[model samples]
Target: MIRALALAVALACPGTALAQAGLDALDRRSELLGWEAVGRLDMPHGTCTATLIAADVVLTAAHCLHGLDADAPVRFRAGLSHGRAVSERQLAGWVMPERYRTDRGALERTESVGLDVALGRLDAPISTTDADPFLVLTDEARGDALSVVSYGRGRLDAPSRQGTCRIRQRFTHEVLGFDCDVTFGSSGAPVFARQGRRMRILSVVSAGDGVRAFGPRVAGRIAPLQAALDRDVPAPASTTGIKRLRVGEGRAGASGARFVRPERSP
Candidate 1:
C-alpha cells in the first residue's frame, strides 16, 4: 500500500532539505495559529489525526472509526506535544457518508476515497480554549501551496506541520491528489489553504497509493457530511470486526491505520 512517487519527488527536489526542515514539531502550543485545533485520535486499534471544525465537532476520516467496537472509546488529544496536550475530550458520536462501507475491498476503491470522510462530536465543547475551530472551504484550492499538520507512527509524540505542500492533481470534484508528506497515523489530517491571516480546511488526509496522498475534497463530501452531522444522523453501524495488528505489521504503515476484513461466523 506504500507509494514511492511522493517520496521520490520529495527526495529529488533541491528544496527537500528546506521542506524537511519546515516540518517542525508543534511542541509549543503557542508556536502556531491553528496547531491547537489539530490533534491525535487514539483508537483501540490504532491512532489517526483529527481536527476540530466546530467547538464540539471534529473532522476525520470515516475509515478511522471502521471496525471499532460499537462501544469502543476514543480519545481526542488536542495540541498534543511531547506527551502534553492542551485539551482532551471523549468522542460522543460520529456521522459518515451513507454510502461508506467498512469492507476492505470496498474501501480500496477510488470512489470510496471521496466517501471516506466523517464528523465526530466531542463529549464536551472546547470553545473557551485558545484553540479555535477552522472553517471549511467550499471553493477549490487554486493556490500554489497548501499546508498539513499531522501525527504519524514515528512522530506520534507530537504533531508536525509541513508549512507548504503542492496539490499534484485534482482527480475529481471529490478526490484530491497532494504531494504532502504523510504516513501511518496521518489519516484524517487536515490539508489547509491560507487566506490572509486565517486558513481554511480544504480536505482531510484519507490514503496514499504510490507517490500521492488523496482525500475527499471539502466542497463535495464535507459539506454534505457536515449537514448530516448537524441533523444528528447516526453513523452507519460497523459491520466488520476490528482487525487488530501489531505496529509495523503488514500494510500498517501504508496510511495512518489499516484494517482487514474478518472471517464471518459459521
Candidate 2:
C-alpha cells in the first residue's frame, strides 16, 4: 500500500491495458452481501484490508503490522461498511514467513513483495453463519479473470468492488502482476479468481499503484506460513483469566481513527 515502497517494482515493466470493470462503492447493505469475510484490520497506527481464510484465521499483508514487533493481538472489524460492522474480534496471534521483513532497505528489494504476507489467529472464531471463509486455490494459476473488494484510502468507510481485473503476468515467480484499482488501505485485500462456481483466493495485494498492483502468489507458500504459526502457539495457560473490562473502552471521538495519511504503510 506504500506507493514509495512499491513504486520501485511498478516502474520496471509497463502494465497491460486491461479492461475496466468500475470500482463500485458498497455503501449500501445490498452491495455488501457475500463479502462478509472481508474485514478491516485496525492497528495502532493504521488500517488494512483482510480476509477470513478459515474459521479462526485471517490473511493479511505483513507490512500492515510494521509497528508491531511481537505477535500481539489487534482489532478486526468484520464486514465493516460505512460506520458499523457485523462482528468485531481480536487477532490473538500473528505469524509471518522467515523471509518477511519490515526494514526500510529490505522492503526495497524485489522479493519483498512475495514475502509480504501474514496470518492472524483470531482469539475467537467467526461463525460460519456470520461469514463463510474463502478457500485458497493453491493448485493452479491458469485463471486470468480477477476481482477485488477492499477498503481504500478515499473510501475508508465503505468498501469498493472492482468486479473485473486481469492478471497481466507473473512479475516474479512468487509475485502476480495485476491491473486493479489498488490504493492505500487496499493492502492485504484478497485478489479473488473465479474457480468453477465459487471464488477462490489467489493472492494478497502486496504493492502497486492504482493502475497496476502486485500480489504474492500463494501456491506452495501457505504451508510455511501455517507452520510458523503452529510453532508460535502458546504452550499452555500460564496465568489467570483476569482482564480489565473497561480499559481504553471510553467514549472516544473521531480523533481515535488514526488511519488517515496512510503513506506509512510498509
Candidate 3:
C-alpha cells in the first residue's frame, strides 16, 4: 500500500536538503564498511530495503512481497552500491504476518502497517566477513537518537543513512512514528537505535506520509516472524509470474496516503 512520495515535502523540510540533516550517502567503501548488513530486497513484484538480522535470514516489509508467488524466487543484495554488492543470496522461502492480506484495500489499512513485516530464508548463509548481521532491539523503549539506512528511490544504487533522527512518537499498538527522511524504495529499511557507535535494529520501514514515517514497533513483531520461519516449508511449484515493482513503485495510489490509526495522546 505504500507508494512513492514527491520529494517536495522532504525538500521543503526545515528549508534545507537531506544532506544537511545528516543524511550521508554511503557511496564509498569506508562509508559503507560497517553497514554491510543492510541490503536491497529484490522481489518479482518490487524492490524494498532489507536488513540481514541473521546469517541466513532477512527482515523486510510485507508489502514488498505483495502478490509474490509461492515458487517465486527473490534475491537479497547486501550493501549494494554503484551496481556492486558486498554479497548476494537467493531466497529459499519467506514468512509474513498471518493477519496480512493482499486484498484490494488491505495494504492501505492501519492493520497492514502494524503487521507490515516479513522474514525470508536465504538459500545459503552469508559469511561474516562479507556481512555481519545486526541485532534487533526487542523492547518498546523509544530512544531519542534513532537512525535509518535505506536504498530509497534515487539512491537505490547508493544507500544512504540519516545519522541524526528521533522518534517523534512512541509505539502504540505495535506502530511507531518517526521523523526519518524516507522515500519510495525505502520499504523494509531498518530503523536503528544508536548507543555510541553500536546500533540495534529498532524497526522496519512500512510507509511514510508527508508528515511522519510509520512502521511496526518491532519489539514484539520479530518473534512471530521468526516462529513462522522456524516452521518454514519449501517453495511450492506454481506458474504465477514473479512480478517485480521497480524502485518507488509501492505507493498506495497517486497520492502517498495510507491509513494510520490515531494513537490517543497521553
RMSD of each: 14.0, 11.1, 12.4
Residue lDDT tens for model 1, 33-76: 45688899998878899987766678888888865665689989
Tell me the lDDT of model 1 at 221. 65
Ranking of all predicted structures according to TM-score, beginning with the best and ending with the worst: 2, 3, 1
Q: State how far residue 191 of model 2 sits from its true place (Å).
A: 0.3
Off by over 4 Å in 3: 1-22, 102-108, 234-266
Q: For candidate 3, lDDT tens digit of each residue in 47-128?
A: 7888887777788887777567877989999999999999998988888877774452444445556777788887777765
Query: Relative to the unseen true structure, what is the Cα RMSD of model 1?
Result: 14.0
State the TM-score for model 3.
0.76
Best-fitting candidate, scored by lDDT: 3
Residue 87's lDDT in candidate 1: 84
- The stretch of ten residues in a row with the least summed lDDT in candidate 3 is 8-17
Q: Comparing 2 and 3 by lDDT, which wins?
A: 3
Query: How high is the CA lDDT of each candidate model?
Result: 0.68, 0.68, 0.69
Candidate 1 segments whose C-alpha is farther than 4 A from its true place: 1-22, 102-104, 231-266
TM-score of each: 0.75, 0.77, 0.76
Range of the 10 consecutive residues with the lowest summed lDDT in candidate 1: 10-19
